[model samples]
Target: MECTGEQFCSIIMDNMVEECVMVSILEPMGVVTKKVKGTFEQIGSPQQYSLCDHHQKSLVYCHRTMELKAVTIQGGNNRRARFNLSRYSNASTTTTNQALPVVLGIDQWNLSCSKQTDSATPVLQLERCKDQLTTIGAQEKTVRFLFYKNTTGFSLTTFESAMYPGWFISTSLEPSQPIQMCQKQDARKLINFMVKH
Candidate 1:
């Protein structure tokens, strides 16, 4: 069933539901968190001298919230073509151009954009993967493009270059929706597509 904007907002407000959904969504998207695994040792005396040793595995925790800002459908199609989510803290104002991370899940294929749309109001796109030849595994997968707009004034190219030395030169693009392309694969394709389009 399709989720309406209201439903999306409700889901975001419900922390329990959001956590569960995010875990399920991120897994198939190949966003795996670092898993810490170890054992425990016990050495101690009976009464006074007792040492309790324990080993714990730390799992990466992902915290995400969604605020439904707008909903748009493709031309002549009833199916929703896009949905926008505003990611902001409680103290954040709507008018301010704040960079928020968006995770886009299109069918099975998932891509993240550092900024979805520009600083122009918060919005995101959920588009279909019409081109099956893009990637082998991506054919049957639905495409979701997460967008973020870095208003911090620091260019993504600069940051990515410093952060990931061997990475390719990052490019910029203005998608149908507001999104900041970041993923290595998506960034390359988006830049090329934007240039040609």
Candidate 2:
């Protein structure tokens, strides 16, 4: 099915406790990476997005921290010879001014939280260089996941972290356990959603 870039999306986990993904808000501003049942509204025009919930609360949009750059080696023995290296370089990373994701009526509006202050948010960033969506900072070793077509069926899609390719996003009943990357020999993480929209 084709999306018009304005449809609400539900990121459902195949084996999560709540069976939905949510932008959880906790004290000190914490984002729940674990999957929970949630109704996410897709915001932003064109292809860019800022997710919103049923209560009109928009999810935090974590901007790109560092950008990849190709730097050429200086002082080469041969004038015609040059070496190239791809690396992450610090850049101007900022977040949107929209209010962070809140459960509405539960937590009051918070204005103190800011990306500049290093507060946590529910927005996950997709790093184009490595082709991974990172929940944490855009560090190389941070918790990063990859989106790909389902192995069994080409039409469906799923998320799998590069660190743990064998495991897919899953959830547990316990709050301590929450949702996590789980490994199942016969399981497939494939699901349908408008990733671009």
Residue 168 lDDT, candidate 2, scale 0-100: 39
lDDT for model 1 comes to: 0.25
| Candidate 1 lDDT over residue span 125-166, tens digit each | 233444432222211222123222232223221111111111
What total of clashing residue pairs does each candidate reach? 18, 2
Residue 25 in candidate 1, Cα distance off native in Å: 38
Instruction: List per-prediction Cα lDDT, in the order shown.
Output: 0.25, 0.24
Tell me, what's the RMSD of every candidate? Answer: 25.6, 23.9
> Which residue pairs does candidate 2 place in steric collision?
20-36, 20-37
Q: What is the TM-score of each candidate against the true structure?
A: 0.19, 0.23
Give one digit per residue, the lDDT tens place, for model 2 in 42-102: 2222122222212222222212322111122245322111111111211222212221221
Single out the weakest 10-residue window by summed lDDT for candidate 1: 50-59
